[model samples]
Target: MSAEGSRAAQIKPFVRQALVCPVDKGPLLDAGDELYNPRLRVAYRIDADGIAVMLADEARKVDEAEHQRLTA
Candidate 1:
């Protein structure tokens, strides 16, 4: 596996079932470099430096079209 992939795998256990969305207090899906909330249609980016930015303000609001595509 690639280095990025390995890092993501390693980080998965640390965040999975642990991290939650600050805005809605909902569960977050660990999508490699991004933590996504399908219920709220928001995505928080994981920095290349290994920092998980869980702040709502730092998250991107996914529009209806993208949300459907992502959740589907």
Candidate 2:
């Protein structure tokens, strides 16, 4: 099998279970060959078909920063 195809085969299960839009904490919908977060307006392309990635928004960053600040 081609590299891309093999990668996709490995990623399919993880994508189905673990891939969620970090910004909204909601399920990402597959958009053609890619995945998209409607709330964050970010599109994630599978890396070499093996890893599903999601870009978090500024709100998440701020939340994380605040969390760290509180913990510190």
What shift in Å separates residue 51 of candidate 2 from its native position after superposition?
Answer: 0.9
Model 1 poorest 10 in a row by lDDT: 1-10
- For model 2, how does the per-residue alpha-carbon lDDT over 1-72 read when each residue is reduced to its tens digit? 553444434566655677787767787655433455555555566566456656553222224443343234
* Decoy 1 TM-score against native: 0.73
Which candidate number has the best TM-score? 1
| Deviation from native of the Cα of residue 23 in model 1, angstroms | 1.2
Q: Which candidate number has the best lDDT?
A: 1
Q: What are the runs in model 1 whose C-alpha is more than 4 Å off?
A: 1-12
lDDT of 1 by residue, 12-52 (tens): 56565687899989887655567789988898887777677
